[model samples]
Target: FADLKRDRHDDETINTVFRSVHSIKGGAGAFGHERLQHFSHHYETLLDLIRNGTLPLSEPLIDLIVAAFDTLADHVI
Candidate 1:
């Protein structure tokens, strides 16, 4: 989130986040963290779309991403 906030088009940060969330999602499901797994799945989907160019990286979208990042922290800890 910090890196992406500094540069919304930061592909490295985006990829890192995607991979991190993907692992979280997998671990969540395996360990019975259903809510986190569900949330991360959707979040991961959004990141996937952004990385694949299916979703445009607009300021508003970045804003949503930032907000979601905050919510994800709550889910994680």
Candidate 2:
């Protein structure tokens, strides 16, 4: 994850990160963690923006979403 952050100029890395967030959102919703669901949904929306090229996948954006994943995991557990 850290390596990806350092080299986010690579399209593949960004897409891989987006897919990971998407999977977490699905699992979080499946486990019925409303907070995780909410957070992941919001986080996914942000990723969608990047995936669609509507928004640039900047370092701060990546960092924020990565942190959101931790929060989602905490809520799930």
TM-score per candidate: 0.86, 0.71
TM-score of 2: 0.71
In model 2, which residue pairs have backbone atoms overlapping below 3 Å?
none
Query: Would you list the clashing residue pairs of candidate 1?
Result: none
Error of 2 at 17 (Å): 2.0
Instruction: Give the top-scoring candidate (lDDT).
Output: 1
lDDT (CA) per prediction: 0.85, 0.74
Off by over 4 Å in 2: none
Error of 1 at 14 (Å): 0.7
Best-performing candidate as measured by TM-score: 1
Off by over 4 Å in 1: none
Q: Candidate 2 on 1-77: residue-level lDDT in tens?
A: 67656763566666786787778778877888677667778887887787789997667877886787687667656
Error of 2 at 43 (Å): 0.8
